[model samples]
Target chain A: MLRKADTSATWAIAFSTVFFFIGGLLTTVAPPMIDKTWSKPFENNDPSKGPTGKLVNYTPQQLKGRAIYVREGCWYCHTQQTRTLLSDTIRSGWKGVRSPVSTPDEFVYDYPHMFGTKRTGPDLSRVGGKYDTQWHRTHFRNPRDLVQGSIMPPFPWIVEDKEEFESLVAYIQTLGRAKNWRPDNDYEK
Target chain B: MPEQTSGRVALGAGGTVPAIEHCDTTAKWFMISSVSYFFIVGIIALTIAAKFCWPSLLGSVQYLTYGRLRPLHVNGMLFGWLLPADMALTFFIVPRLCAVKLYSEKLGVATAVLWNIIVLGAVVTLPLGMNQGLEYAELPMGLDILVVIAWLMFSYNIFATIFARKYEAMYVSLWYIMGTLVWTAFVYLTGNFAVLFATGTNQANLNWMYVHNAVGLIFTPVGLAIAYYYIPKSSNTPIYSHRLSMIGFWALAFVYVWTGAHHMIHGPISQWLQTISIAFSVMLLIPVWAAVYNFFATMKGQWHQLRESVPLKFLMSGVVFYLLTCFQGPMHSLRSVNAIVSKTDWIPGHAHMALLGAFSFFAIAGIYFTLPRLFQRKLFSEVLANWSYWFLMIGGLGFFVTLWLGGFWQGWQWNNPAIPFIDTVKALQPIWLVRFFSGVLMFAGIVSFVYNVMATILGQARDEAQTV
Candidate 1:
């Protein structure tokens, strides 16, 4: 069959387009079409709503802080996704435990998803309520000062601007606490 | 004298050789631009590497902060360096192989200019905290439009030339080039434009689709085209088998699209998506190995040429690295291994082996092989070329090893609740230091390459002008 007349160009173009269509339909296009139970946030106490209830949305400040996160290209280093795998779960203590896997509903509000490719630092999936706002400010000023060997770049620029700094703090502290599964604490202070 | 006499004899038998209707001016300009970008982007990468070791180094400058500089380094490498090198090769090879001059030198020059403009926009805007936030498609909409315009001009010029070709039979390299051009345009539009309307996980899924395809369709096909043209021509042999080349080409095209989803494995995306991606990713090894074997078989008796020719040395070494990337790709795409290395440095190290080791080597070789011919003179210094090759080879290997092992060390430690996160970062300090120094060596190697290109092109041009 390979020894047939030269149709290399035609075959290459046709197969490439077809494979792209199939892959797109199955992976990219199909995921959003199928409704899953885990696509939304839920609490154990809410029996009527079930575990797939509509999760609370981010505050305006948190949204602004997310904008700051994207602006600074924080996603390049810090990934927000915690997989169901043991290694991922154990490493990233989501909700103060080694078990809460991230679901689609957690990212329903994410316009441009921050499921970063690299984890140069610890996962930020459940980083909200883990550290105080003061710690974030100091770390952003000089990461090395707080964590001796931290590779995170200093965001002194973000620190100088009070609005950007507070917004970013608001954003970081809300990472894992968006769902009402736990008593959501206001980390604004 | 005997070699010169034999060359004339070969020329006599090598048929019509149609007036050498080449776009030498545009081709030389593209090569020079690509080398300069290599120098600039190499320095930015070195800066990024240093920040990983000394977090406070240049931390005060908001523009040079790790986040901004990271994108700068990425865009610079992708658009500034690699893309130009690939386009330059297309400019040179397409015309010669088709026995026709480029359709429009003016359009080609315009494309090159606009290409750099789009990259310049990314460099300026990203550092200023003005960005669109998409990983590979980080440029703002205005600049993205400019990129599309530049690519359109380039595609039209090449296709017009090919359509009017005086040659009868289309070579395999031409087929590859045409496929790359069309697929690149399709993926770029779909990934960047169509993605703007997509929301949530759908956007993430499509983003990976674009990200992975950019490497698979654009760089892979174009790099292979350069290899298909140069390797056999240098070895004084036909391709090992035209039949195998077709199989490799179609297989690569079919398998790569399905494999993009592997990047999203265990993330917010569905389980079925991961399954399809991993299955196809493992299957991807077939095409990759087919090409690898074809290259080695083509060079069966000509292995000794590696010591003599710098271009062949780069091309052959690229094939070896290509093999490693494919092997590692399949292994890591599995759910188990990916779970361990997904967010760790292992993936980055592996990505570099493909980007810098495999494809970048091919680009450098294409430049070296074509530059002298474009200028009608031999290279100025083979010694400098050899030195550049070794430094990059050693430095790239060293860089990959440190990151690969350090990634595993960090991942394994992170899995233990007893090990604090900061402690993992501390333990990896020595590896980071090695990575930094090795990066410096790679930077030096690029500097040597740029200097050699300048000396050869300029020095030879001066000699010819004086002779005339």
Candidate 2:
């Protein structure tokens, strides 16, 4: 069991790891480059005109709903970020909706960034104006009733729990509406 | 912490026990605790997989929803099951490798108990929405601090033991253990606390760095340490080449940390950063193959041991899965492949092949090989042990295959906007069901393993130390 104490071998591993680590960090060490049009809406009057208007901060109620969204793990299934691809923009919302790809400016205040990794359901990046409040209420209560093939779990608590339902819906409407809003499905067309 | 007849000598190296004389309390408890988490977190895994099939299975309970349960499952599996298992085996192997009793058996036991408390904290906090919203570092701040403290204690014990070693030259396994102790501390701290200071998408940088290195720096190295020690010891041979071992350890340490940004390939992270990460990820193949070659080469004359030796069987196949898992990691890092499958079920499939298939195999093999030595008793049932292996093999393979294929379909479907997103989710339902059943099979295998281990431990001790 007694091998040579090979302190050099030990030193090699420790130093090499430290060296490469510093090199690795050096690559990403800079603060992320801020986008040119981060929060600026395309049109001053219309946030949805293009990716030019300011990103709207959440109202107190929307903030409350964002908490519920996180608490319920909506981010696990419904992604918030739109990838830099045609399919992501088209699939996250229909082409007529003119959904912009998610940008860092829209998430300036996103503390624990809800830009989820997977699309277990759909990208919620442009879900803000896609459906009305009543539609969301119905969808949250029993998703299967609205969408035939949906696997989203029913949040019946939101239906019965007054404050929970309001906050969640408020947050849902703000998804892509604040800055990257698409007011109508036919806008881009 | 329980019953200890202090002065018993081990059945060393070949036909016998651990390579040293020390109290088994710390290592044994850590082993038992980790094994028990297999059932606890295995159930959690099954439940999570099941939710994909039946999303409303626990629809009403706020705590039991898929969202809360999912984080718990990951935390439980990583911290509760995998990390603890690695520590358990490390506690056992390092002392033997160092040719010294553990520096402080009492401290080891205390750390073991404290580690459990940290996991328990995860159980309570995560379900109640107390998570930090970080992936691997999800445990609340208090638990994170507790974990760091526990690691410091354990690392201190291991470092002291190595320092006290009477030998002039250290082994390859010792090199890995030492490297991981230093690397994990750096990775964990940077990922968890430092990210708080990063604003906007910048946090994603630290996040990926932390999570990827969590596997690369922490689990992979230590898992190799166990495999390196157990393969040679179980096969009753020296490593095929000390030089290869040297190349593998140094190369892996250098490459692994740089590859963290691979997770964000094609995403919003800087393009150059992604390219650099992917390059380093591919470079990882060199170290991975080096280790794999060494393991297989050591098994050259010992190939026949696969038939008669259950532990060797596990150790060897673990090597195979390690090869497959490592291969997939770099392939997925490629931008072309990453564009399609990075966000799909393929990611988890890649992960499971390593955690459940590769490392769990090594950890279990280590337990199977070392348990008898600790108590100086025979395995209660070889039939049961083999059953565990086959079950895990089938189930683990099934889990990876179904998810990999399913994830590809998902990526393709999403790529076609005409298909509609809901349809894509619907298309994956059948695959999710298959994954759920695979989860069932894996749970069964774990139960079989736990029972076999329990019976072996409780069975009568051998009368004579020289019997083997």
| lDDT string, candidate 1, B1-468, tens digits | 011112121212545545764756667767888889899889999988998888878877878888888888888898889989989989999998767788889988888888778877887898887766778888788998998898889888887876666554567787778778878987898788877886556677778888988998888889899999989876677789776887887788678877777887888778877888899999989888888889999999989989888899899999999999889989898988887777888877898998999999999998888878888776767788888999899999999988999998777886676787889888988988999999988987898888889888787444432433
Error of 2 at B338 (Å): 1.4
Q: What is the Å distance of residue B354 in model 1 from its true position?
A: 0.6
Clashes of 2: 18
Q: Which lDDT tens digits does candidate 2 get at residues B1-468?
A: 121223333224233334556787889999999988888888888988988888889888878888898889888988998888889899888888756788899999999999999988888988898867777877888888898899899888887887666453567888888887888888888888887776446677778788888888889999999999999999899899988987887778778888877776656555677888889899999999999999988988789989978889889999999999999999999988887897898878988999888998999999999888887778877777888998898999999999999999899887888887788888888999999898888888999999888878888433332242
The fraction of correct interface contacts reproduced by each prediction comes to 0.63, 0.50
C-alpha TM-scores of all predictions? 0.92, 0.91
- Residue-level lDDT for B153 in candidate 2: 95
Model 2 Cα lDDT, one tens digit per residue, A145-165: 999888888888777888888
lDDT of 1 by residue, A1-189 (tens): 432213333444455566556665666666667745334443355646532234567789889999989988999988888787766776665445564678766776676778889888888987777778788889888777888768887777788899989888888876766443342433344
lDDT of 1: 0.79
Worst 10 residues of 2 chain B by lDDT: B1-10
User: Which parts of model 1 are misplaced by more than 4 Å?
Assistant: A1-15, A35-53, A94-96, A181-189, B1-19, B460-468
lDDT of 2: 0.79
